[model samples]
Target: MTLPRYAYLGPAGTFTEAALRVMAPEGTAEHLPMVDVPSALGAVRSGEADYAVVAIENSVEGGVTATLDTLAEGEPLVILGEVVLSISFELVARPGTRIEDVARVSAHSHGLNQCRRWIAENLPGALQVPASSNAAAAVALADGSAEFDAALAPPGIGESLGLEVLVSGVSDRASSMTRFVRIGRPGELPEPTGADKTTLVVHLPSDRSGALLQMLEQFSARGVNLSRIESRPRGDRPGEYSFSMDAMGHVAEARVAEALIGLKRTCPVVLFLGSYPAFHGEVTPVEPETTDESFAEATAWVAALRDGRA
Candidate 1:
């Protein structure tokens, strides 16, 4: 049997690689490390890999703009699963590199942002440089290619890469976490787990009063709970925007299907990103199965009567 191929943002020793391990353990599949999120997603899109895992959201940083925009605008891909990991950073440097002697520190933008307070307090005089990823930073520091004396990376990077940990627990909040999603070529969504989330993007037909409200009502009126909702510019018009939403329930459910149909009727485009199992915790059941069955039966009855059937 051939093992599956998985791509992630890395050179290794990055949080993304850690998340990938949780999804595909050692020896289960071949792991291909890409330079960035687009390349990872592109690997899957281009058939170079079976799936790609990348960070979607960070609790402190909110949405990862690169990941969000890529998924929103790129060729279709389906989210297969999600993984959430608590994040922490360590200040690593070449062995015997003193913190006081460190003139600069390097990290991925998000990692730098997450450790902003710690950097400000400890490395006040050090310049900040952004790398493609934490593991990239570690690699540079290890290879002596990075001009910075130290890097903010995952805890064990120091040991794995033969660096030294000058400081630890650098995240602003102890509870910080990042959410990653497994994406693959469009189609073959995960089986409904009773606890799931469906993500989609809605671009409105026109800007009008209560237009946003109208979109929300499509789900709100039907008791479909929304897990996340964000508006991004349509990229062509100055005032026009697109709404990205993650709502509770699988797209296979009647209420979710009805809400999507209503949204399609109101919006110019409704892009179905994919429905997959939820993380963090199991979702509370939204509605009874019988309620959806009853709604489906009534809809069929109405369609039959419209055809003049007794």
Candidate 2:
């Protein structure tokens, strides 16, 4: 039997690949590293791979617009799981190179932005070049064709690529972390753990003043705890946007299901992204009044009343 294949943002030493490795483990699957987040998802969408792992958000940089936009506009895909990794950067250079020997420094845009203060304070006069990824910067240096003398990347990139670390612990914030999601073709949903989260996008009916407030009331009134909410343009018009939110329960939960039903009636579009296990291990507190049995009883009561059985 052939082992399953997984795709991830790559050139091998990327943080996305590291997160995927932890989820899939070595020898469990054939991990293929794609050049970008879209390509990783494309591999799975095209049936070339079983799943793709891509960065969804970062602690220091907010949402990864590339991944967010892709998930919203591209072919339908469902998130299967998520992984959160603590992040750090190292300034690595080619053999025999020192900080003084460097004329330019390179990193991915986010990498450079996260370490902005460090680079400005240390390199002083070096040019800042943006690579597709930090690992790509390492590849360029290894290829001996890069004009840059050093790269700010995950420490593992340097060790794996045989580069020397010129400076360590370089991120501006030590507590920085990133969240990555595993996506696959829409299929069987993951069995809901007590601790789970459901993600969705809500496109409002209009841009009226109280529209957003009204939409939020659906969750608040239902006591649904929203862990995250972000707005993005609806792509076809001006002054209109869609809200992406993550709530603290699975769709199977009565409270969450009711809230979504309310959102669908109130919004022009309600895209169900996925409901997966929360990586944080934080479970939603179950309420006695909103248990599955209670919801079923209430649903039956309404049905009987409509049939003239008060």
**Predictions in order: lDDT:** 0.88, 0.87
| Cα RMSD of predicted structure 1 | 1.8
Cα lDDT of model 2 by residue, 263-292, tens digit: 989998888889999999877887777777
> Over 4 Å off in model 2, which ranges?
none
For the record, the alpha-carbon RMSD of candidate 2 to the native fold, in angstroms, is 1.6
Candidate 1's C-alpha runs over 4 A off are: 288-290, 304-310
Taking all chains together, the TM-score of candidate 1 against the true structure is 0.94
Q: Could you tell me which residue pairs clash in candidate 1?
A: none
lDDT of 2: 0.87
